[model samples]
Target: NTTAAAVAMLRDIPVHMSYSIAVIDRQGNYATVYVNPDRPAEVVERRVSTNHQHGVEWAWHAETTKSVEREAAVEKLLLASASIKDVLSGFQRPPAYQIQYGHDCGTLYTAVYRPLDASVELVWPGSLWRQSCADFQDEVRTIRFNDGGSGGLAPTFKEGAVSS
Candidate 1:
């Protein structure tokens, strides 16, 4: 969600611009993304776990509850914060926004994008956070979630390609 929006800003494009984004889990196992409704002509190569085409469908499951809770928490934080940094900072727990579900699932990293400066801040699994700036056109930034350590770097990708 926020990451996708940040990516849109980084690319200097409208959020509804026709593009497909994929987000893989920490283990590089599972992945998900919200399909772009504005671009019905675009084809998604992967299966989308949660669909945002119509509206949020709350199925009976713990995973769904966690997802809904995180969405609500992020919305509340977004409204209260004065800046993107504030919003990112607020994500550090008491509310426990970071997920760590042993071997099954967990949050690998958190990121914040500052479109005005073309900069992004990445928070790794060990609570280590770093910031970097780049030319969104020629170079793209990415975060890799691994089983041990997680990190990010700005890599050269084909123009208009989305990384998650």
Candidate 2:
């Protein structure tokens, strides 16, 4: 049931890569995907991957707390969006994104809240789904850099590099 919930969630989300959802448990655990025998059956908290751990445990907590705060702000904007003017007020503002869950497998739930300056919308559905989430920040950064530069960041790595 968890597997199905996970898969369903992944399927529901708008993403490019073909993926399967895997629910991670409380003890930093997630069931294995049988599709890849070589891959581990479990992914623990941060056994998954992250750019950097907080300098301290509390630091991480502080960040999580900040995220929850940001989440609340985003939700508030969505709830208060009664007019297009309200939506366009922050039209160019970046969105605050987050994913949260309770338990896994049975009635699993994963949500992606994208609250831009525009009208905020949320997709809270059963399943853990994300694609290129981490890279999105980098993508934004790239735009900023390129916009500031005369031209743009050149593509250093060629797609054909691996063909030979």
108 Cα displacement, candidate 1 (Å)? 1.2
What TM-score does candidate 2 get on C-alpha atoms? Answer: 0.25
Q: lDDT of all predictions, in order shown? A: 0.44, 0.31
lDDT value, residue 13 of candidate 2: 51
Model 2 spans with C-alpha error above 4 angstroms: 1-65, 91-142, 145-164
* Candidate 2 C-alpha lDDT tens digits along 1-164: 34345544544455442222335432333442222223323322221111112222355643643434444555566578877546433221322322221111111122333322212232222112233433332211111111112122221211221111
Instruction: For model 2, give the 10-residue run with minimal summed lDDT.
Output: 139-148
What's the alpha carbon RMSD for model 1? 12.8
RMSD of each: 12.8, 15.9
As for candidate 2, its clashing pairs are 2-105, 32-41, 90-117
